[model samples]
Target chain A: AQSVTQPDIHITVSEGASLELRCNYSYGATPYLFWYVQSPGQGLQLLLKYFSGDTLVQGIKGFEAEFKRSQSSFNLRKPSVHWSDAAEYFCAVVVSAGKSTFGDGTTLTVKP
Target chain B: GAGVSQSPRYKVAKRGQDVALRCDPISGHVSLFWYQQALGQGPEFLTYFQNEAQLDKSGLPSDRFFAERPEGSVSTLKIQRTQQEDSAVYLCASSSGLAGGTHTSTDTQYFGPGTRLTVL
Candidate 1:
């Protein structure tokens, strides 16, 4: 069985500050990884995904994540976060037969 | 293109009552998925369907949960005898299945706004 762990439950960052959210997964082989964001009362929106190829994958809203096989991690990062970037973020791994396992999610609170 | 859409954006049911959530995937999409997301938690896989065939339903919590995609375009997730634990947002997503013989990394999925289910 595959599982995902997000170490942080909540994080606060000031505007214009760099941010990084940690994510780790346990899978037998290389699995499809994805990052999604959700605002209050809204459905999740895909931020980025890593299937194969370049370790660093860029996503919308000036976000990116690096797939580190050695670390079993796919951490999302941003050079500087905007106020509107605050939301709950999730990391997911696709298991066999197209089933997905999602992390507990990290709630980001942007401070002015 | 219009993204996936879910009906009855909010549903409130009493305990032991039955509820049905609907999902309308993107037109011509071959794959559809249903997920459950509790408050302050990420979404959990509940079921998956390819066309009109349900491929996987192992993630459903119990027998009270049932899902179907009769014609392959629209799907429904029905919960009989709802419980407090069943209170969560139900999300639906659709993808254009694997491209060629290989899966494309960009086989991106489009999601609906989700139906929030509250069991009282």
Candidate 2:
């Protein structure tokens, strides 16, 4: 079965520190990858996506993700962490036009 | 420009009761999707619609769940005989369908605030 995995359930980082969230997937073929962030009581917001070109994709709010086909991984990265960045991050993959598979999600907590 | 919107931000339903959630996508958005999000979990695909046509509903958990986009602009998700396990946040998203070929997944999906459902 196709599945997306976010190994870390929760992560903590000091404010202004670099951050990385890992995401891996098991699929028959290389699928479109996406990163999303959700704050309390807010809907999921698209951070970045990797379709075909560019292994590294930049997204809103100073976020970027690198898609490694050989590793079947699409990891998200940020240069610095902010208190407002404390939220849930999800990784999703879609093989076709619809029906996206999502990881369980990782919650980030920014510390002072 | 306004973003996607969902009605009844919160719904409390008794077990066995039926409920319907509404979603209004951005104007001219041709692709719409529904997802179910449990507490602390990522959103799971529930269904997808292109224009008024429901292209894929294989992600729907059961027959009790149904979704429709009659005019290709607004959509509704209905649950029959709700159960305690059915409690979750329902999210609706929309994307411009201008991506040609199988590149539909390349479009960015704009999500609504979502409707939190509580089953009593």
Candidate 3:
């Protein structure tokens, strides 16, 4: 079965600091990776996706993720995080056309 | 344009009761999906529908859970005789339904404000 794993349950970082969230996936075939951000009481918003082409995919809100095939990892990174960036981040992979598996998510807390 | 939308943003149901959640996908989306998210856990896939055709429902937890998209647009997820374990946020999403060819997966999926189901 295809699955996504996000190691960090929570992360605390000061405003303007760099942020990195780790994600590992297990799938038999090539995986279509995605990063989503969900603010408190809001729906999940797609930050970026990696289907093919460049391994490093840039997304909205200055987010970027690198798809490392050998390690089965797709880690999200932000050079500088804003205070408003504090939210839950989810890493997802599509097992099939409409079947997508998500990680437990990592809650980012930005210290002001 | 409007993104996905789900009705009854919050629902409180007693154990053994029935509950229904609604989802309206983005305009002209051919693929719809349903997911369940437990507290502090990521959303789990529940079912999938492509143009009124339910392609996969393997992710549904139990027989008590049912979903439908008769018009290939709006979708509904119904739970019968709900249990405490069924309490979670029910999310709905939609996509354009394009194939990923061989190894890759399909395109982006837009999500709605999930319906928080609380079984008491």
Comparing 1 with 3 on lDDT, the higher-scoring candidate is 3
Summarize candidate 1's per-residue lDDT along B41-78 as a digit string, tens digits. Answer: 88899988889888889989999999999998999999
Instruction: Output the lDDT of residue A12, model 3.
Output: 99
DockQ, per model, reads: 0.51, 0.66, 0.63
Candidate 2 residues lying further than 4 Å off, grouped into runs, are: B98-100
For A11-107, candidate 1 gives per-residue lDDT tens digits of 9999999999999999988889999998887778999999889999999999999999999999999999999999999999986655678999999
Clashes by residue pair, model 2: none
Question: How do the predictions measure up, each by TM-score?
Answer: 0.95, 0.96, 0.96
Interface RMSD after interface superposition, each candidate? 3.1, 2.1, 2.6
**Candidate 2 lDDT over residue span B42-100, tens digit each:** 88899999999998898899999999999889999999999999999999999987433
Ranking by TM-score: 3, 2, 1
Summing lDDT over every window of 10 consecutive residues in candidate 2 chain A, give the lowest-scoring window: A92-101
Query: Model 2: per-residue lDDT, tens digit, A1-112?
Result: 7799999999999999999999999998768899999988888899998888899999999999999989999999999998999999999997778567899999999999
DockQ of 2: 0.66
In model 1 chain A, the worst 10-residue window by lDDT is A92-101
CA lDDT for candidate 2: 0.92
Question: Which CAPRI level is candidate 3?
Answer: medium
